[model samples]
Target chain A: MSEWWSVVETARRIADGEVTAFRVVEDMLVRITRVDRDLGAYLEIDGDGARTAANEIDRKRKAGEKLGPLAGVPIALKDNLVTKGIVTTAGSKILAGWVPPYEGTAVEKLRAAGAVILGKTNLDEFGMGSSTERSAFKKTKNPWDSSRVPGGSSGGSAAAVAAGLCAASLGTDTGGSIRQPAAFSGVVGIKPTYGRVSRWGVVAFASSLDQVGPLARTVGDAALILQTICGHDPRDATSLDVPVPDFSAALAAGARGLRVGLPKEYFAGELEEHVRAALDRTIAALRDQGAEIVEVSLPHTHLALPAYYIVAPAEASSNLARYDGIRYGLRVEAPDLLTQYSKTRGAGFGPEVKRRIMLGTYALRSGYYDAYYKKAQQIRTLIKRDFDAAFESCDVLLTPTTPTTAFRFGAKATPLDMYLADVFTLSCNLAGLPGMSVPCGLTPEGLPVGAQLLGKPLDEVTLLRAGAAIEAAVGLGDRRPGGFA
Target chain B: MPTLTRKEVEEIALLARLHLESDELERMQSELGVILDHFGTIAAIDATGIPAMTHAVAMDHAGPFVSLGVLRPDEPQPSLPVDEALRGTPKRDGDLIVVPAIIPGAKE
Candidate 1:
């Protein structure tokens, strides 16, 4: 068996009797053991649980029963997604030892699809930071460059897939969590339309903005995983009650005759030279393939980051108010309930979490509500309108996923500097559009650069079609990080 | 950009129910001030005619399948088992999670 097997190949091989599910899972376990020590991609490696599930898949196959689409595929979940009977922590000391009694809807869907639960991957504490550096546990290193951070709050999921620790992993995106990390790690990550996936048991982080998606080696793998997880769920009121489209069928449509819009505001900023080159390469590839590339404008792009900061943190502050230490997490004893709440939270949350909570609380304060929170919401409307207008002229919009390649640890000295890392990816979340990052090419320094595709609401099909085209044109196939490979 | 005072940071922390050390409070004051300053750009935007988009489904482009509001029939459903509900509580007395006294000067 090859070490770097794509999710599609893994499932097909296992289904065709070319490989046993047990053997596939065992190989993944061995690879994770060998590779994950330096990467810190997984918070927990559920070897026993994964093997048990693999054995079940093999049994079902031997019994001549039809298997699910992801049968025998080993996948990891971002720790923020709860798994019943597994110790699930949102990379915060607050949830350090909490074992969820219920599983997230996505995890349940993955299990039903016969995907092996490899374990939960690390994330920014409560999905708060752009880089996994803010995780309360071990920081996930970029598989491409150990010295640099794996972009986060989905950093662990992206790194794991890049390192071949798992076939693919589920990552939650609020602002740019999943896509940014996938870009930095050189993998395919998609943030489905906000209401497309149910968020039932996932840890709440800026509830309105959060959406769970897959990070994988190829766009098809992501589509398969997304197919299994997305649908209307009564448990998640915000879930869209739309029929799931056949994404795999859509991939073959390619970029021909597609109207790809290049958002002018996205290109107006100071992008790193390598990133700019990669974007140009992607645009050229699409145009060469008969995709009509037109320049479009999203006038309110500059205000996206500012509005996101206010909106995400404001919602986070309210959603996180449930962790009062009296419930299902770490508790600090104090003479009074209020003091205990304060002490527990102070001790549990990391610096970034505290900072966001403070900022959010202040924004939602009585006198400042209209100025900060309300104003940000209004700006959100303008951002959404900008996308709506842009989409009218084009089938999809393309841009660089990040302003630069992955940076060295501690390169972003200030919180604001770190926040800027997600500037290019934030507007999509605010507008609730489906966004994907596909690797375009490697920089001169050997770091991978990604090109982002933004689609209209619930239009992941167009993004996938364009992404697969980019994937083929770039032709960076089966590339693995040096040491890991 | 509005700079937060030390007192303001402390007040906000209290409101957020986070106990901060003196050093952390100082750090937060400076950091929050910088972020708020950046947020001034959003404040400067003229959005007089725009309505606040509290949810993504509120957008006109959300498509036919998505409803602005989803209402499930209100019916009795099986809740989490008592043991499961209390499974992760830090301090539990039987099935009930234990908490500090809500009233001041109350005995434990």
Candidate 2:
């Protein structure tokens, strides 16, 4: 019943009959009752749904039937993921009353593996903004300091995991959504290589950049969740046919004989002093563990934010066009079809979503396509080329996850300023590389700092290996976000 | 930097089918201009000979990740049932999803 138990640890106890699935589910509900009111991590609490699932798992265990890998583990899901009979809001009021017809591929896999669905967590509306403030619903607070923001659009998932509200959670990283929040909240989160996991039933943000991954208190738990979700799905056209590796095996590999690269450009820029110090310490720890630390430069890193804004919005503009009043979700009553479309969208979407839609419309306008959208795609190629070249010199690359630790809720006044918070993590999505954020150390202010690891395509194993080594060296166990310790 | 004027912003909003309030219109103009100006950095990059990459990772049949050739036979597949599809519709009648009528002579 301890929140400190990693997903693997919880699963083992369940397998050995040390804890019944029902009891674990009950304990998780009790914890949520006591803690989640202050955090606002979960937008909806599905105690009944989770309990029913848990009871079924317990019944199977009692009947001498084998359980799945994640037996009885309660996991939080980002609101964007479609869950059968559960409200999937995507943190927007537009879809306030909509319950998806079915579940997402990742959610289905988790259910099959015996993970209980606790509830849907909050996010920036349609995953547009870095801070969860852009959510049409309530903003999720950082567990470390409620005044500070949990880096987001996956803010709720990160906060939930950080607060020990769930054993682990699933978050979709479209533009550093998962990693930056995980960094701020002091959890391990990964955005697997593009197409490593299916994007079948998840609400599309930026189809090309969106990736569903896990947020966990420990590296092993992150790997466990990632393992369960990775593989091919015909439903997603871009899903890879690659084999899902046994990620747990990589944890035992450690960091020895691995060459970890430090991208020079990542160190440069307006990175906060505490973040840099933490990065330096993380590098030293990895070097001490016999991993060769090399200096590499991704020269095109500076262009990531610009290219990403253009590319993601363009995709979002198209993907979100489906919300015309005729189908599911909120609709405004208007005399004409056009007016209904306008009113519904304008009233439903938040300011950030509107801004992006306008920007994307401009970018893809009749005459402006070549100047913006096409150019951004070309820039994406250059960004990928930079990562491709850097990987040749090192097995993995490391950098600070965010330029600064979590700031106050209203710290970023302008939309452009908020966009800058994602500068460090955006390049990975642009390049379609697998990357992760593992807590390397804490800032002097007691806020957590995450050091990111970037790996070659389909090479998450090396990143996890390095992450486990660094997690052990830094000992993420000491600092408690809200109440776990 | 290619800045947007109010007229241009209105036109863009029209294209996006979002009816911004008057104040929201003004705010959108300023905010979008700033974002587009910021995005000028990408266009400045000399991408003369580089082909545009629509997907950051190649999903082509020859690509390492999708090397197995992901072309599934295009046979009919089971999809969401009609009742399930219509379940969340805001307005519906007899399984036909409802919407505001097309304005007469209001050609899009």
Q: Each prediction's Cα lDDT score?
A: 0.91, 0.89
DockQ of each: 0.76, 0.76
Cα lDDT tens digits for candidate 1, A394-453: 999999999999999999999999999999999999988999999998888878898999
**Fnat per model, in the order shown:** 0.86, 0.88
- Misplaced by over 4 Å in model 1 are B59-65
DockQ category of candidate 1: medium
Q: List the residue pairs that clash in candidate 2.
A: none
Fnat score for model 2? 0.88
Give the total clashing residue pairs for model 1. 0
